[model samples]
Target: MRPPGGFPIVCHCLLLETPRGLCLVDTGFGIGEAAFGALPGYYRPLIRPVLSDAEAAHAQVTALGYDPRDVRDIVVTHLDADHAGGLRDFPWARVHLHAREHAAATRPATSADKGRYRAKQWAHGVDWMTYDDRGGETLFGLSAIRPLCGLPDLALVPLAGHSRGHSGVAVDTGSGWLLHAGDAYWFHGEVASPPHCPRTLALTQRMIATDHRERLENLARLRELPAEVRVFSAHDPRELDLAVS
Candidate 1:
């Protein structure tokens, strides 16, 4: 959906029946806190999502007729609040993440980016399964592959740039491959055929990206991917049409 100022409001997550049972690529958000209204501190929320509350996340999982507990593993692209907020809802699941992100989030230096990592916001301290370089071969000439914590087919493709350990989780869905590009390219148009990226998208990425050069390199490689390879970012409005099942 288009938000004010022509921006698209998008949140993406994936639930897959992997070789190791049900899994989630990212958990979008959590319940609203009236306390957020009262916290008059220096911490600034970088981006305010269109989702005022996280009930949508719960409803989405439940609507699929799967218990939140049944959603066994969670592969986090990073630790941004929007991506990790809903983590509190599922403690039984083992959370998979990049090693760098785990380090960055656990110990923050500034308030500007601190609020984005809300692991404490979850009732259960996130159970972590941090990974190093583990994925498949190469895609579009970039090494966007990493084995996911022994889960054969699922791989953790490190394309870090949006954050310290930003990675994309690739699910080989038999027919073809689907990559949860995360913030690597916030919108499809950025990597679309006849490639284009909005001024705002470029500007925003430059401002927040930890390593702009690396991010751009990965992005260029992502573009070379076959059109059949489904690549969806976290904030792309088109994500709603993609099924988690």
Candidate 2:
């Protein structure tokens, strides 16, 4: 089938200028098709993403005249294959992620989450830097922000929901901030559309979730953020336009 402008889906990596070097939010598809483990049945009906050679994080950084090796940090939302897919491409970068998420992915309770990880995607050792819950630290009175310190302007927004350890990457863009909402919800319309979700998707998430209540609560929080904030989801390709570098 012809792609409907941005169909099937691909992840987006938010680039933030930092003091030490650049910080990458999440990696998109790897150099080739990522291998899938045993079928989830739900995954069977799906068509894989059409990775654009012209749109990868590595290529984009190179096109901007900066070397990919210069990227000093990579903050992951979670370790789902799609979210952690391109990690191997930038091996030299120090990775950051939620401690709960790191434990879940690297050491899951059951097979559901563990199955989502593909060995090829995470060739690098599991050494993601972890962030702890700060007692409601606020930025512009908004409680969803945390600092990246040595990395500068980038902040980690704890947006757990789609996965146990999932979090959002918030970048201060002078005028406002951009929030990368991982897989908190699939389509943008679902954010305020009465929280209705297909049974299959919801069930899979619940079964694999390390904390479902936290995820839904985070989604609620997203709805309440200031209008100046623009949120993006990993599966929502439309967001790429909003976050284009």
Candidate 3:
């Protein structure tokens, strides 16, 4: 969703320092044009991502005085081109995601799925760790898959709607919990007491959503989350600014 004054649409990815190793919540546009290579022609004009090699997760990890290889696991919110683009940068990392998402992206039963999910991102044949909605605990009234592949502090909260199996990655930051609400909502005001979203942004969300009704339902649930649990979306720059501050 385009913001007023032509503000850039940011792709916020979370890099966590875990006991096992470094874990990435989602990988924004990968090195160079690797992420855009498989995308359709029309995508360029619509999204207009600012491509920069320095901003790639690999480069950022290296800049932080850590080897890129240390990132052993990647938990993705969905298989969308922008989200999963950096998987190739950390080919050895075990990619964790929802089973339904795996099917939709890999198999691609529908036209929308075909357009959104790009195969080149995972062309290296990643070590995939997929989960489902069956038997799991709940977090703030939302179904959650905890102890993600034995990582106690991390959990996957199923918040499908944007994609067939989109989810929010919940990180227990010791001080508190932070939920990376990936594309669940674009604007910061979406989770406000009386949730508000721009008409254009709302239209974009609806146009992109696989199930608009389910998206709204999950969004309502997000609004009810306790104040203690910090929640932020993938594309909201204000949230990102607050996070960095």
Compare the candidates by TM-score and give the number of the best one.
3
Question: Taking the candidates one at a time, how many backbone clashes does each contain?
Answer: 5, 2, 0
- Model 3 stretches astray by more than 4 angstroms: 1-7, 34-36
Q: Write the per-residue lDDT of candidate 2 for residues 1-245, one digit (tens) a residue.
A: 11233334557667777777888888765555324332233443454445555566778888999988988888887777656666776888888887777777667677767676555566557456777776547754345446654755677777776777677877788888777878776656557646565555556556656678877777777777777887778775556666564
lDDT (tens digit, per residue) of candidate 3 on 1-245: 24444645678899999998999999987887634586667766777777788888888899989989999999999988778878988989999998988999999998878878889889989999999877789887778998888578999999999999999999999999999999999889889977887787888889899999999999999999999999999998899899889
Please give the lDDT score at residue 147 for candidate 3. 80
The Cα error of candidate 1 at residue 25, in Å, is 0.7
lDDT per residue, candidate 1, 89-175, as tens digits? 677788998888888888776674575566465546767898776444775455655566657677778888888889988888889
How does candidate 2 score on lDDT? 0.68
Give TM-scores for every candidate, taking all chains together and pairing residue i with residue i. 0.84, 0.80, 0.95
Specify the highest-lDDT model's number.
3
Superior by TM-score: candidate 1 or candidate 2: 1
